[model samples]
Target chain A: MSLNESLDALRAKMTSEAAGAYEEVLQRLDPRLLAENALKPGDVMPNFELPNAEGKMVSSLELLSHGTLVVTFYRGSWCPYCMLTLQALDLILAPVPGQQASLVALSPETGGRARFVKDKYNLRFELLADVDNAVASMFGVLVRLPPLYRQRLLSQGIESETLHGRKGWFIPVPSTFVVARNGTVAHAEIHVDYTRRTELDTLPLVLRALRQYS
Target chain B: MDLPQIGYFIVLSRVLNFTHAARECKITQPALSRAIKRLEWELGGDLLLRERSLTQLTEFGRAMLPLLEQVQAAADVARDEARQLQTQERAPLRLGLSPWLAFPLIGTVLREVIASVRSTEFSVSVEAEPVMRERMLRGDLDVLVGLRADTLPERFNQWQLFSTGAAVFLPRDHLLAADELIHGSRLAESVLLGASEPEALPERILSQIVRRLGRRPSTPHRASNWETSLQLVRSGLGLGLGLSCWPTPPELVARGLADRLPDYEVVVETIAGRPQSRAVSTFVKLARASAWMNPANVP
Candidate 1:
């Protein structure tokens, strides 16, 4: 099943009131602003360096130097939706040793946490720590999770330490981008609703198109 | 409810300038114009008259502005009420603890409070004294745990927690680290650190040193906050002054002042006559009864 199908199944389990509340939260997220500020298909991708799972610093410039780069910014291991999306990406984008394509995931969590997620999921892609959402903000995808949404997250079993960040629950808008070798954004997908994600099936087409730059 | 669009439109209605209106809404001009257009489409008809260098609300737009704002206000109030209802069930307890109390000391009080209180969910706000006081007064915070105030406003009911003195923190290998007690004059000998504006307590602490020693700090550099100041001190930048109650980090040892700085009284304050939630009242009671907060333990 696709990532959205899995998300739909998860949503189906929610009660009517819960579903309604979820809808309201997404509506208030201001998709219009996200569209205005987010990186476009032709926009140049900025270079950044973030700590990887093993505490090694990873640079976007170095990643692109190899080939096309597929980067996804997720919430973290705590979010079930993010978990499904990440697992989907891992299965669909399995790295081919010296192919002209690379995959990496970044989150605002610490490198120690990225290490745990990598180990538990056995992910092929390198997971990097974008401390304080520095990389996400560069892509114009960082959003301060509403206080009420944060409280709801806390009320449901998740510990405060996991959600309440120094800047108070900032998470990326669940964005994925394919950058060409020339550093221009070849393709971009930013999900404001979060329950929806960049369809994993589309990556093959986007990558095939990136063959020119590769 | 289309609150976002209508909210944007309402702001646009007032400013009568797309650029200025967009600036007010914190969105781009094109985005604001698009929102106004979408809202007009939804409500049926042109709501705004946009021509070369001219912006004005049409008759329908002017008529809808008040109604739209009313609807928005009603929506906001409903949302807030619902949030409060949801919150009342098992809301987050906002605890503002001043640096005047040590970490372990606050930890002990919180552990006991959670055990006794029905709700275990809580958030801690560590800020300068004036910010915390204003937050408490504005009802943004449930309770403020500490700040040595000689007198609080009549609107607040305060419980005296304890009296603790301030101390100087130094890197273990610093020249003055061997001194039995750091005198005020000795503190003036080195560079000092303090937080910049809006963090009033650190400024007050730094100022107090100048008043007693009768000289400004040799050369003071400002840090963003207490933690940053401590980090600078740990890096051996200079001496740092802070509440004696803050837990001393392993890298730095705290020393008392030979010149007695007046003891600071940490107090627990909440709005007077306001009905206290179980969490708030329980926290206050537990804090009051905590043995570590007892006044007799500190000199």
Candidate 2:
């Protein structure tokens, strides 16, 4: 088996383990189970336009114009998992010359909050502000925080006002997709909760598969 | 009372000259005189012995200086405490992660944090490279996992967890896997899978490979996350460079190139002046335990 096959097998085993543990933790999760809407290997990506940290506009077309496009959606700059994951991705940008893809990260954070990722992690990829998570909602990845957790965040002064100068605090589930030049998603991963994240080591394997498919 | 004016009075009383005291205070001579007069009026007593040719502090002025200094010192302490309270009110726990580690680690870490911290609340964030350092400097993030530099910010404290080695990620069938050591020139012709720059991978490995080849990589591709990169590698798009800290899946081969690369020691660092939260402390402890932290190497 190739490296990708072994990883897939390992992933399957982990998912099964998580499923068993999930039986117990399911009670703590939101009643509305997360919708299964992940992009498939050959699914066409929808067009999206969002602002960069400077509030300058960027679109899916422009981003996809590169031979390959690596797009990641983050909860915000404040998430440690997002930080680590992005930093890891920053470390592995070469080797996928097949698509000549541009890497873009989108989040609800704008201006300073958006810039915080780059300022803090020293990441060079384009960090975009998804504004209201409108695009994320369209992708069906937006989820509401449990009411108690929402209040807890507010007590710590991370309310919407502090993050975006608004009263409503909304966050999206973190997701990532590898889109080929033709706009088809070659690989995608989405996590519902705040804690778990996509492993950084698997990116190269996915890119290699993408190159094969392309 | 206008304490600064009183302070001026104390300084003038010592110097015994409005001209000299004004220069020291960065004010005009007339301003110094007015300040001293105001201090005397506020105290309802003459605190300075002033004559045309000679000036001195009266006994009352001399006695008052030490008392005023005490009051000022107390005020400074109060101001500092108030600032601390404000910061505590806005306390945030910024945590950094590489894409590979985020998902599996986040849930457990936060669950550990919530169990330990009942009073203090926190906001967790993820960030990439230089931003983690910059945010720590700007007082935005309280702690992070980043490259360990010889010199950290003066006000920050760092804990070294462990050093992760970089490896060449290849498919099981790759010809190079048969060789004990992967060479730089061999990596050039093969499609290379990498992140944007060398934030986590050792700089030496990347530079050596490029330097030995004498140019940029021939067919380089970027992956936003490690999982994707691994997927790309498995599909035979190219090879990968990654940390040995985590186990590679059974199919892929992760081997250290000859003359291994020394990239960074994973560390948990905090802003110098910020007070540590219970959650932050607990998370650090667990991270140390999980990564087999060594105390002997603490910098």
Candidate 3:
């Protein structure tokens, strides 16, 4: 099933009270400049180096050096939508090496949490911890959660600080960037609505086109 | 008036999915659909055959595809030219160099050239060779300093600067450190340290060695850059492959490879058949006259 359809199925199973809280959070979140101001195709992507789940440093140049790079940013592994997206990506990206491309997912979660998700999903790609969302901010995906929403999540036993090992209640709007080997963003998809994401199959097609064009 | 809409149409034609094409164009699916509809209205024909599961172009769309591609390419050239004009108004020279070049040599050459040429503001970008070539083609870069494995594209005019060889770097305490030249046969059992990216030059060189040896070495650690690769060698993790001219750290020893590796020529490249700006021409002139272009002068 498609990622959106899966998300819709999960949403249907949520209690009305939980559903209402999610709706309230989404309503309070302002997405006015989020998508428009985010990075776009033809823009130069900022180079970054972050620690992977195993604490080894991975850099943007290294990923791009292979071929086109697919960089996906998620709020954290705790988000079910993000997990579903990661699993979908893992399935589709199994043949990425054959396509001469690399995939790396970034999250504000700690290395431990990233490792947990990586092991749980049996992900073949590198999953890096963005630490304090510094890399996400560079991509213009960082957003501070509304106070009431943070309170609601905290009351539900979801503490961002404890999960991410950071004090800020910040998360990156789920986004994906297809960066060419030239370090230019060939495609960027920033979805302020967390339920949406770039389709998995489309990424390999973009990589193939980039190789052909270059 | 909506040239970008036409470009979007071209993208949609390729992807055959409104949602995918809209995401590529950074617009909503409805917006892209509306744009296509407006285009069809203006052209007086339906360009696409839409269905629940299948999206294909009609007869008119097939005929318009090549023409639209040419139009988009021409528009891009125009925009690139305008952007280049604006850039030159502020900085006379926007130079890009490849990271593989010996930094000290290029640094010295650039310093000498910039000092000799007065009132010419220079902005520099250090990037990979492919990126530099793309920027040069797009008119974003005035000149490029990089290596070419084969014949360059006809659009680029290139002048050979200097050539460099490759070497294998091993830890100081390694058994191979005592040898004057390291051979692929000797590295059969040793672990190789290389850049994580498969396309990196060092990794390519390592693969070449593996091919020659007929047996692959165990590569346990892959780094992101030359520095990291060297560090891995110094930390006794594995041996590394690097350019002969790169400065060696105190904890490692660099030796010539027994197998003759191909020599890469560092060259200065600019767009061919295009009128050169004063800054570009002057820099080229200085580069030709510079001692750094001669192999004998290089350390």
lDDT of 2 by residue, A86-142 (tens): 776677774344546678887765324555566567787888766445455545454
Judged by DockQ cut-offs, the docking class of candidate 2 is incorrect
Q: Whole-model lDDT for model 1 versus the true structure?
A: 0.69
Off by over 4 Å in 1: A30-32, A157-164, B1-299
Angstrom error at residue B204, model 3: 57
Off by over 4 Å in 3: A198-200, B1-299
Mark the regions of model 2 whose C-alpha exceeds 4 Å error after superposition.
A1-214, B1-92, B100-109, B119-124, B149-154, B198-204, B211-215, B289-299
Model 2 scores a C-alpha lDDT of: 0.59
If ranked by TM-score, best first, what sequence of candidates would result?
1, 3, 2
In candidate 3 chain A, where is summed lDDT lowest over 10 consecutive residues?
A: A160-169
Tens digit of per-residue lDDT, candidate 2, span B1-299 = 33356457657767788888898888898878776675555344577888898888788777666545433332333234233433434334567654533234446556555543434466656555566778778767766765566566676655554566667888888898897777776776777776664554434346666765787675468775567778888988888766665557789988777755455466667664355553454454444333132222211
What's model 2's lDDT at A130?
60
Which candidate wins on lDDT? 3
Per-candidate Cα lDDT values, in order, are 0.69, 0.59, 0.70
